[model samples]
Target chain A: MPYLPTAQSFLEQSRLLISARPTTTRITTKYTLPKTSPPDPSKSKSPPPPSSEPSQPHQPQPPKATLTLKTYDPISGTCLKYETDKAAEVGRLIAALGSCGRVMAALPAKEEAVDEGAMEVDAPVKEDAEGKAKAVPKEKELKGGQGQGQHKGGEKGGGGGGGGKKKKGKK
Target chain B: MATGHLSTDEFLIRLATLFESRRSVNHGSVFLTQKRLSPHDLPKAATDTPLPPSSPFPDLHPPHPLPILIRATNGKSKDKRKDKIKLSTVIQADELEGFFMRYADVCKAGMSGLKKRDRSGRKAKGKAKKKKGASGGGVEGEKKG
Candidate 1:
């Protein structure tokens, strides 16, 4: 099995989000969610991998809420929900969220983003501001010179493709 | 201008390499289950071995602790002895970011507490510097008089 991205990477990339909101155990940096998501619980729960190594001991199954990390295709309407509890595996998804260039979606989050049954909304979802207005804050934040060097790296990771752009186009 | 997009496959590859270079904090308990033996779990075989299967797995918050169950699927095998069948250690996930995030408050509290102490030390230093400045001013006044 491929080893997970080191604890340091996740620690570095998403440290702000994690430290900024200590109570939040799970956070989704959705590049884009459709305007009328109508979130489905069944679809969200990732299918466990086949029981190949039943003899292996101490293979704990991930609990429901802290378990899923999905990326939905706006065009095909497919959701790629990851299932492994491996720090390396799930950590990749978590790190991806930090690295992803999350532009504001045209639509705001609904009361029911996903039927994550016991998944508590750890913090209030930020209200979607007008398109251009949202840009102002990001630009000002860029001016503050916080991790501006990483911005170049963002181009290589996320800025190259427009996952959010595609999702927004469909909505 | 910041512009790029992440395809899922691409992101996975980048996570393996780019993110690996940075330094991470030690949460201490992560190494406990990291190199654990998943195979050779049969109790008959295990009891003969020295190390007992990992007994104490860490508890999780937003709590996603997967149970470590060692299934005994032998037909007509009704062995009730606890030593005959060993259960798995109760831990989950390959990556530990979630684990760290779960205990972030503890780490944050420690970091902020250190910053506060550092600030107090700086204030004390500033006070000493001011005292020296006052003595210099007194020497200058004597010369003027």
Candidate 2:
């Protein structure tokens, strides 16, 4: 009798197994991508005058170089110009290279840091009389990177680490 | 949107930079898209918005990112026609801010080193290596995404 067990007990065991079945849950997503680009939500609202930039239908072109890093030869009358495509990269490049050399205007503008680049142009700016150089930073950073956030102190300790160890070439 | 403003490579670079900062949490919080900017809100400065006849300038340094906008294309025709395609670049303002903040110090350090390079041509090469960094550690983290 014990080996066979009761029919009621068997039914209860069967019910427990059936109830233990794993359930599949489906995740619901709200965002549905449209067939085409989503319309600008702010289009209906009127705003200031739009840029006169040519809007002839075409692929959006890659951005152009805004900052020009020009290195002037002190002895010679020649200069090497480096036109960086990104203002941010130029900033990073200058930071990586250390000492904007003579091209302090190349510093990422809008930062509160003491810009030696702007300082070097101080005389010329003063001479301009129009005080144009003072506006140079803002003019350069027209892409709206607000330099006001957190102040990273002493970025790079104000100097490139000591000179690289020159590899002694064998004759 | 596929404005194709910041390419995958560029995004990866930013991602690498943000990770290097050890601020991954902040990085994840960035939304890939922003409420579409008005065409008029586009930057107005010449340097800021130097749209030209063509954009095939060969530059010395690698091309970095620009402030992405939901711009209208005027010449979307291979047959020499113009039509602005409305697409959004995968760049968010906060992400850009975070990237700049993370690399700001690193970039400054790089700039600081250029002074030494100006002194000696041979040493300049070494300084360049140093600026590239990880040379001292025997392994410089590749400056890529």
Candidate 3:
């Protein structure tokens, strides 16, 4: 009876061992070996790291598009095509014409060149010349300088002589 | 009338606004003359917008209210200051409106494309990182147990 029990237990243990051995082998064969293998060098390599240097600052670039306009051709009596890269230039031109008109109006037409030249001269000189012109009448009353006195003398001669003639006729 | 004193920034702003208005009215190209506005009057003539009184650069011309010709392709000089005076570069009103509209549309399209590209790139990167993490965790768990 003892021998029989020992034989039965041994057979059961052998069966269990056989089953367990396969499962352990299967797990090891499937997972362990594949993982342990060296990673392919090509797969492991990554692209080069991004450059660490600071990037250049971006600047506001000019617009690439061009704008064109049609202007009157005085000689041809037809419109001619003109182009400008900027929009502001046109506005400025209009404004300039307006100012030119004002300049043309304020000064005598014959002295336009002289006035333009004077405007270009030093500001102090222009102020001084204006001041001298302003003082001309006042200086005439006190000192009677040639340019100022001549005008005053002519006025007095015309008025005073007329009054003397009237007084003589009354006497 | 005093445009000569107009600052470049003021001139530009005016030029932009002018272009916008002209565009609305179906005006053709805008032409800029060689004569520049006085820098002083540019701020007022260009726009109705008021600037901050306390600004440090108050002396500078306020932004322009109208669009201006900034560049001319056929002009002899590329320098803005020098080229502006040349008649060859002045663009007609109708041409300017067309150019601005086209430019704005192109810019809008480019911006949208960039946004879409950025979103797609982020999604792809996130998926790759998640896959890598899952694989790493599975390996670690098996080794520990």
Candidate 4:
């Protein structure tokens, strides 16, 4: 059986999560639906193991992929499980739910920086500086002069270190 | 849960209508996650393959993809008390690929529609040509010519 999520149900959702792996891809949506009956036991608790276990009763079974759509409403407390292997059905549900909002990739910031570093080891982050230099050539010259002045001030501060070194030597 | 599936056209229409209705509210977010397989967790056959002889860092270019686990939370400041819903279903790679492609198109359509609506709203507000610099000068210059 295929799970047909309604437009109203889609609007009622607070969060939607789609996990895509090489072998298995899962689409899960959490709805803050209005509570009707006493919450279903399966809603708060983990899914029953029996539901998953009964599917594979035979031995020497080959690796066969199955699409399972599990809808759990927190209010109703009823967890509906639908299983299908049809590509068309799975694609349709994904397309429908996916359109509700934008799909932002869950990539970590640190790993992306590391990946960029590994790929472009020699490339320096000078694009912004170069672009500013090109657009405002006068500003670049002013900045260079300011940098030189700061360097000269630092050199004078280094000369003052001699008096401090003499006091340390006396101590 | 509805038992019967909707046609592709009807499904898109319903989604668009829902989106239009929910545009004003802070209805929360939806995102996609993709996991990359790490070399260590890969199958023995994939690990057995040799790297290219010309490369310096052979370890960097592993034949097997890296295993990356991506966790998606609601927002930057996650609520500790609220129960985060976790649900996942397993499907084949080919079907998943098709979904991603279609999802991209859907997002593009949704974004373009929103942009069009925003432009119309701005026009209604009479905020056109609020600029006072080069753009304004250019308009005056063209009129004089």
| TM-scores for every candidate against the unseen true structure | 0.20, 0.21, 0.20, 0.24
Better of 1 and 4 by lDDT: 4
The Cα local distance difference test for each model comes to: 0.30, 0.30, 0.33, 0.36
lDDT of 2 by residue, B1-145 (tens): 3234555345445534432332222111111222223223444652465444353522111133223221112123576444223323333333444443443443333222122222477788877975665453434223431
Best by DockQ: 2
Query: In CAPRI terms, where does candidate 1 land?
Result: incorrect
**Number of clashes found in candidate 4:** 6
Ranking by TM-score: 4, 2, 1, 3
Model 2 DockQ reads 0.03
Task: Put down candidate 1 lDDT per residue, A1-171, tens digits, no spaces.
Answer: 122254333323233332222221232321111222223646757654447445554335212111233333233333233333333234334323322212111012222223122222211122221122354445534443444456557876684466456445543
Docking class of 2: incorrect
Candidate 4 clashes between residue pairs 3 or more apart in a chain or in different chains: A40-A77, B37-B65, B37-B66, B37-B67, B38-B66, B38-B67
For candidate 1, give the lDDT of residue B91. Answer: 21
lDDT tens string, model 4, B99-130? 44554454343322121223577775544433
lDDT tens readout by residue for model 1, B1-145: 0123333234333332222221122110110001111223334663464544353422112222121211111011256433231111212233223332432222222221111223677899978976876676678778999
Ordering by lDDT: 4, 3, 2, 1
Residue B140 CA displacement from its true place in model 4, Å: 12
Candidate 1 to truth, TM = 0.20
Q: Is the docking of candidate 3 incorrect, acceptable, medium or high quality?
A: incorrect
